[model samples]
Target chain A: MKRAFGVMNQHKVMNDQDVRRALARISHEILERNKGTDDLIMVGLYTRGVTIAQRLSENIQKFEGTIVPVESLDISLYRDDVQLRIAQPIKPTTLAADISGMKVVLVDDVLFTGRSIRASMDSLQDFGRAKEIQLAVLVDRGHRELPLRADYVGKNIPTSLEEQVRVRLIETDGTDDVVIVRSGDGNNSNG
Target chain B: MTLLLSGLGMVITLMVDVESNVIGSQNVNAAGTNRKHILDVDVLSEDEILNILDQTDAMSEVLRRDIKKVPALRGRVIVTLFYEASTRTRISFEEAGKILSADVINMSSSGSSVDKGESLLNTGLTLQAMGVDVIVVRHPYSGAPNLLAKHLPKVSIINAGDGLHAHPTQALLDAYTVRSKLGSLKGLKIVIVGDVLHSRVARSAIWAFTKLGAEIVLSGPNTLMPVGLNLVDGRANVLPPVSVQPDLDDAIRGADVVMALRLQNERQNGGYLPSLREYIRRWQITKDRLSSASKEVLVMHPGPMNEGIEISTEVAHGGRSLIEEQVTNGVALRMALLYQVSAGGYQIEEEHPNGQ
Candidate 1:
């Protein structure tokens, strides 16, 4: 199966095993940076990031033997897609956590244009005064309209604007795989 | 208390939120009967609405934090004639009547004498002799409440909703909802979406919201939104008029408030909309559609939501949805209206045996 987002031209073709390794690495980095999960939180961007954050929290629970709080956000109201195409987007859920004086990491599936991240950052402002906020993503696609970047990234895939990146996972797509796709025009192809 | 006898039922209630022109200014009875936008906030200045809501809040406390009863309106009898089947609005006035210690009588015409071809006029005249204080009425006809209010004397009329004409109580709850969320209604960009033509809440909301100095944008498919109803009796008014928008996204863009009225399926039969799927695809408050507005935008709906159809389940349940708050505010708003109409005229009596 193909990743929901196709044609991610990162360093190499990552299988499900490679994706798992990347998550573990990212999880370890989050654990090390925060020192401990004492006052730290992981917030996911609606549908996909929710799973990513939950998986990372589970990984952290293995060593700490305690669960870290993870919150899911439905940024439909804060999405950048209002005037654009009509898509039945997912609604996000949030957990009531006192975010003050805590480390917050906002997770998303893809980082394209960075507009979504900017919106997510704005959405979190209403919840409370957070001491610190960080952004993490699986793939950082570089055609950013907004001057935003992820603090933790699984991979940076630089590709033509037209190329689509697909990240497939068993938890979602029933298979684990990642690939970049052509524009089907034959002239514009991702190797 | 001075009682005026009439052929129709008489109702006694408090008077609140009555906006008359500049103090001592004369009302020149216009050329023809004018239709006032009861929900527009602009007709009433911001201060007026703020004052009303503040008063409404105080009146609300009487019904909410108390023992569900008030001596403020004792010795009053009000007839609740619900021509439509509804749970929320019907019970609100009933509760308001009982709370104020008024004799509450309900007449649902399903198996009543109305089925025997008795006109509304005859039933109203018959109820008049019963010595009622007020008539809280809901009728399917657009001008039924106003007609009843005109023909009847002694009894004040509280319009729960009159067809697609105006649902004043619902509008009051909407005003309460916006006030609860924003703490104020002045100078906000409020957009109303979905079936504007058939939704009385939309019509009433326009009046109440406009009265509070908020800008209103009526947005929906051209077929669903009938643009020319903002005037008093369909003529121009002193208030700022409602702006029309065919595109939902543009209407919601940078909007401070977005209220989605339910899409009535019956209008489609009258060439009002193309299809429900098309309407949802184009106008439903989708996730992406929400981001067009500023972060502070509020999403509201009068409940029994269509879920994924009119509004997505996610957005409806999301943090922005004020649906529950709207329902909660309904009881208090109706109570406030009742308090005003029922007890407004009740001045505390001083100890003067000869005054009576």
Candidate 2:
């Protein structure tokens, strides 16, 4: 029934077990690079990034026996395309603990245009200056408009601008997988 | 000439269809409106009112933060042009614009060119020539903001208060304060005490609260009550049923919220009331009069309160009073309005289909 809608072209790049393995590996990579969560804090972009940050925090607690605090940041108010597009709903950006003198790790589900990360960086400065800032992503699809690269990456999937990479987690989308969707008509009408 | 008129009509219809197609293709935010001015709450739909309230929740969060500022409206210029005297409304608008990082300029009739016999249109043209983004206007005549909105097609106009016509932001903040405390406005009995004829706040509230599914009861002297509130200002929109009770004690019975309107002393010279002492003896919102309502009934007053005349001093500062929070929510509500109107594009310059 689903194939009747021409959805057959979409396929999963990473399954549930593959996603678990990738996240566990990224958890170790974050710990190994930062040398054990001392002044480290995980700041998640809104929606999917928040769930990813919570999973990473839980994995770190399971392995290292210390729970790192996770903060959620909404960057809609800091977007550069305010006039070009429809207004996006502004969500609450809450930071309970100070980010000053701390190693901040920004986490997200996927990195594509890199504009959101630029807005996030601008939003983070208003709270306080961090000692160091690093980027971590579950999937790194390769068209970046800004000069930014993730310090820790789960998977590198190179594709054309017409293709879309969607990461679905059980906490948000009721599944844990990464899928790539390609337009059947080759016109990229939606973009 | 008839042929030419019909030809023009066809062209206008085709243009409207093409414009709608463009908007549909872009998937523009339908939650936002193309309204360039907020002169009154009578024209607002239910969805538009709810959207403003929802956005005010986000703005309130920013107000509670340590920074209390955002760059959402950075570089936008807002000018307050007041022909009437106001302290809270003017300051609230200025602070709201400043919090959104917009530069706010204040101009009053005493200092500006209005004292030198300059008309409102000329002043509006001067501001438009200087490229101001918005003009917050308060005038002593009704429909003053409507005049500015009709003339200044590029700039957004917000009516702070215009005679006895409307004070939309006050009504929005009142709805916000009530909804924040009591959960929902549906089926809530909101009894408005004291003057209803000369109150812009009460006028705006009647439209807003009724549209949100609340039952409104007006209580005051008969001379201070408007004749037909259901068709207020002879506006075409038929409002929900609103009852007017002359006896204050009967109005307070079993009410969920009681909002007291200020009795303007100027109304005395017009023979609207007998005297201040007589008005207070009958209409003042005293403690005994309040206990007739439910124990959980909330009290509100759109200030500069008359302590002994309209409401007692203890009740004004009492636990049930939401006066202070109303001032705070006023800033947030104005921020939401400023951001929405400026971002939601100006009104499309097209005549109505029916040609009213």
Candidate 3:
């Protein structure tokens, strides 16, 4: 749902330290699930998702002392809702290394509705058939319309349809935090 | 005094209402809105051109992948209706549509029902009945795509090339090639040589390059040059001023990009030139002539070149020539256009109850 701007209630759900810890925990979980980065590749959706993926890669490299390949995927072409919105300029999808026979982990900031993840998965298939495909998201605010679930989630904020979860990272937005903007009566708080 | 003041206020309010309606209609004509067709570059805003170029970059990335096919327009139908013969434009449009997974059907006037005197309107209605999403059209008459657009409100019309009027896609690819090489087109000198009288490519290039802030200079034989181009369609207000340089060498000197147009033999039955030899000697883009341009000057030609007659083989095959890259970019550029026009403006379903 499109949120109307101005005079809305903004609540910082996760601060800088909280974001860092959640990403660190998610990174450890990814490492445990994939078993030491062997034949592992990270593919991040464009914009903020790419930076979060890079941070996860750094955390993994520090823990395992091994570097994993990171790629960026732009799913604008694969979007199911191409007719719903105005067309924006497409960002380049870079997958330098071959992804065949590798465990591909798709990373993103917030996983809501799961439509973007669906589009990302569709885009990844055109590159090559992966050995396996997994998804990692920093926040999973329910309301998934697709039969999809994240393997590693940083936080679960359980948001209402009128609320929006925004992830601000240091690389893209010059900060690290997650906020929920609630529309209507500003005094109400369910947290 | 009070009565006169009230009358003035009413007039001002009415004027503001009229101005807003005009602005609203213009917004509808902008790309990605109610503008479902691309008939010419003259109607395209600067932002629309930039948006198309930026999208072409992403399409180029798709072309580099091993599996060049994307399901962007899957299950959609695109028809290429050509009233004239072409090699590259038709093939490139077909390739672009297929790359996006659109089922492309190619029809030519020679073999199709068009040969049986089927009117363009009838042909369009037939395709519409088949539920084709887009029509890439090329015709011998100018404004053919516009005519199709007027009648078929549901179908998107992309003008491949229409008479001596415009070839917007070709001009776009040309701009993409130059911009990729030269970083930016702003304040650069672009010299277009030869056959300006019957060249749709040149006409479109004049609008596109000038819109991108490149100064355009038209240089060709006197007989082939149109007099007072401003009078062509009364688009002088929108079209940037272009100078006609009769001396090809002078035009090439200090130029940033030199474009050579094919001397169209099929359209030149009126003795527009005294002889091919004389045309070659006076207007041919030889390596020596190119040497006078900027050292990093780029060369371009819209294909099926008359080689020795308009441009020398050495220059066409030279390191600076972007002829082949233009062909590659042509497919990518058309892919961007096909994707943009086909994707938007559908009656979107209401959001799922679960908010998908």
Candidate 4:
């Protein structure tokens, strides 16, 4: 209980160095599993995931000496949990790209219950199809209700279900960090 | 408005299948019956209307939450010339034109040269000379819109209900009305009752319904039915499908819809009918008539209805009536037509040879 309290506090929040180390490990794993980067395509579910996919593609290109195409998706309409809460999530507009006969790797910052990844599939159909699609996340906290498991997971942090994960990136927030807050964070709180 | 619409919408008209080689545009087949609006009963059918609706859905996305303006009809001029009077129909065109950024000139017979008996042909020619690309006309003379269209080589004529002729836009909206209510126009039995002879809405509805695969049985009094007139053919303005008995009971037997057209008692001036009582008893759309028909039948009319004369107020306001939807669709459809006709001319990256 004491160790969990230390991890949940602000002092142990992931910084830029932690994010770089995690992405470097993800880049090597993604290239290794797919055998090479030539047949791979990375598409991030917007908005933050879009930046993550681009950086992951760039990192993979640098480490493995091959290019991996990147795309971004917007999935506001295809969510099942939207009516359960009044959160009006304005999905970022997706970039135009035809994804036919290619493999797509959908990326996100955090995968908790894995529902967002399923909703992303519904949004992806408005565009064309690909041979296969895989999931890649930076943080995977396993309290999942849906049958979604990431192919490339950077960190597996098991915590109480009340804890909420917040991912902040410099491209969007002028800072890079992944922190957990309790039910009283006031932002991600149900209260 | 020079509207450069991307060819994205493709709504196929029902009976007018894609394989059918028949189309009745004014330029192509003179043997056509009503070439003015009936492009194809099947092929070049309402797929274009459906496409327009689809493109409209797409364009609405572009409009986002901002002021609804696209650089669609930027440099073009659309002239709204009406010899008669209208509030809903007239404003629909104006609003549609303004949204697409077209300069609109509203001309009425009350003030314009129409009072001096200026020919629709001469006025069309004058508008054509003024670089007007499209003409939306509502004249009291049946087929005057088409006659004006015949003279204007460069201008596309949109028939906003000609005098006792046919209202193509009204029919398009009616089709949209059915599409919205029932989700599709396939094999829907729409029995159009009242003023079949005189309602331009009826003529346009017949052509469009046949195109959309909605089987229709036009029913009304003998004096009101305008049959054997040489109207424009849709499939090359080919011959109109045949005129039969205008019996209301037989028409409504198994219909999926009953569209009641208004009775123009003012136009009749007590000459066409013996009495309003007789007209209502013979042609009025009642709940009983509807009840005897299909349970899921829809009731519709293009407004200014004769309460007990053509249809009971109960039926008009009661059930299955898409009367209000028709008016709303009129705005959307006319917006679509104006958007398609005028918005793309100035924005043309390549010259279209069809630019006569």
**Number of the predicted model whose DockQ against the real structure is largest:** 3
Interface RMSD of the predictions, in order shown?
20.7, 2.7, 2.5, 18.3
lDDT of 2 by residue, B1-356 (tens): 23212222111110111122322222123444534567777667777788788888888877887677778778788999999889999999999999988899999999778989999999999999898989999998887787787678677889999887789999999998999998889999999987887788998898789878898888877777665433222333233457877777777899999999988868856777767777788789888998999899898999989888888998899998999999999999998888876674423444111111
List ranges where model 2 is wrong by over 4 Å. A1-5, A8-12, A181-191, B1-35, B228-238, B344-356
lDDT of 2: 0.79
User: Model 4 over residues B102-142: C-alpha lDDT tens digits?
Assistant: 78889887877867888778888888898887788888876
DockQ of each: 0.01, 0.36, 0.41, 0.02
| Lowest-sum lDDT 10-residue window in model 3 chain A | A182-191
User: What TM-score does chain A of each model score against the native chain A?
Assistant: 0.84, 0.90, 0.90, 0.84
Q: Over 4 Å off in model 4, which ranges? A: A1-191, B1-46, B56-66, B231-245, B343-356
The window of 10 residues in a row where model 3 chain B has the poorest summed lDDT is B9-18
Who is ahead in DockQ, 1 or 3? 3
lDDT of 2 at B50: 81
Q: Write down the lDDT that model 1 would get.
A: 0.66
> Which of the CAPRI classes, incorrect, acceptable, medium or high, describes model 2?
acceptable
Writing each residue's lDDT as its tens digit, candidate 3 over B198-259 gives: 78898889878987999888887766665544322222312457777767888888999999
Q: How do the predictions measure up, each by TM-score? A: 0.54, 0.85, 0.88, 0.56
By how many angstroms RMSD does model 1 differ from the true structure?
24.3
Where does model 3 sit among the CAPRI classes?
acceptable
